[model samples]
Target: MRRAASMGMTTPTTPVAIDPADLAGVFDRYARDLLRYCTRRVGEQVAEDVVAETFLVAYERRDRYDASRGEVLPWLYGIATNLLRRHRRTEIRALRALAHADGGARAAEGPAQRATDRVDAERAVGRLSAVLAKLPRRQRDVLMLFAVAELEYAEIAEALQIPLGSVQSALHRARAKVRAALAEGDAR
Candidate 1:
C-alpha cells in the first residue's frame, strides 16, 4: 500500500533551477546598497564599475548559490570585497581623501561657535587616515565591513568567508591600532 507523502514517506526532491531572471531581483534589491558600500570604499568613479562587475559575476555564478549556506547579500558582499582587494591601493587613497574631505565638510557646515570643535575633528580625521593607512589589508577589510558597511560580526564572517573568531580578532586588532594612534595624537 502507498503511504501519503506526509506520513514519513520518502519523496524525490527536484533540483532547484537558478533562473537568470532572479539576477534582476538581486540587482533591484541590492544594487543601490552595494553602490553605497562600494562608493564608501573606492569612491564614485570606481564604485559604479565595481558594482557592475559584482552583478556580472553574481549572474555568472548564480548556480553556485546554496540557500543552506546563507543569503544573497553576504555572497554579493564577498564578491565585491574580493574585487576591491584588486584595487587596494586605489581604495586606500580614496578613503584617505574622503576622510580629509569629509572632515572639512563637517567643519565648514558647523556654526562659527564650533570652530574649535571643527579643528579637533579635522585633526582626528588626519590621525584616523594615518592609522587606516598603516593597518594590514585584512584588518582594514574587516574593520570597514564593520564600521562603514555596518555589517554584524557574523555577516562579516560570512562575507569574508573567514571564521567568526577571525572577524573578532581582526576588529580588535584594528581598533587597538586606531586607539593607539589616537592616544599618540592626544599626547602631542
Candidate 2:
C-alpha cells in the first residue's frame, strides 16, 4: 500500500472482480437498470426475456469479462444489447402498436387540455413513437443507450464496441431527426 501510494496510484471505485457463483449479487445490483433499458427498447412485452437472456449469457461467459475495459454494468449492457438485436422486429412492432393503440388516450384524459388539444397531443405522441420506430437501427440503439440506459458516451461506446466519436455522431443525428419529426408533427 505504501509503495502504491508513493507512486500516486489509487484504487478504482468499481470492483474489478466477482465470484461467478455469486451472480445473484450482480443481478441485484444491475437488474433494475437493465430492466429499465430493455423495457424502453422493446417495451414490457419482452424486456424480461432480454434481461434474462443477458444475464444468462453473462453467467455463461463470465470468464470473458475483461475488467480492464470497464465496469460490470457496461459489460452486462453489452450482453443485453446483443440480445436486443434479435428483438429488433419486436421493438418495431411494439412501437407501431403503441402508435395505433388507444391505450394511452386515457393517459391524457386529464381535463388540463380541451378535447382537440388532447387529441392533438395524443396524435403528436403517436407520431413520435412512429418516428422512433423508423430511426435507423444504430441511431435508435445509440439514442436508447444514451436516453433510456443513461449510459455515458464512453460507456455507450464500450457497450456497443464503437468509437466514442461514433457514439457522439449517432446521438447527434438521432436527436436532430427526432427534433425534426416532432417539429413537423407539432406544425400539423
Local distance difference test values of all predictions, in order: 0.78, 0.79
Off by over 4 Å in 2: 1-18, 102-121
Q: In angstroms, how far off is 10's CA in candidate 1? A: 20
Which candidate should be chosen as best, given TM-score against the real structure?
A: 2
Listed per model in order, the count of residue pairs whose N, CA or C atoms clash below 3 Å is 0, 0
Q: What is the per-residue lDDT of model 2 for residues 1-188, given as tens digits with 9 covering 90 to 100?
A: 01212222222554344446557867876898999999988887699999999999988886666544446777788889889989999989988986785635665565655566566677776787888899998899889888888888988888998999999999999999999998886787
Query: Deviation in angstroms for 116 in model 2?
Result: 7.7
lDDT score, candidate 1: 0.78
Candidate 1 lDDT tens digits, 93-176: 865774566556576687766677767778787778778878998899899888987788988899999999999999999999
What count of clashes does model 1 give? 0
What TM-score fits each model? 0.79, 0.81
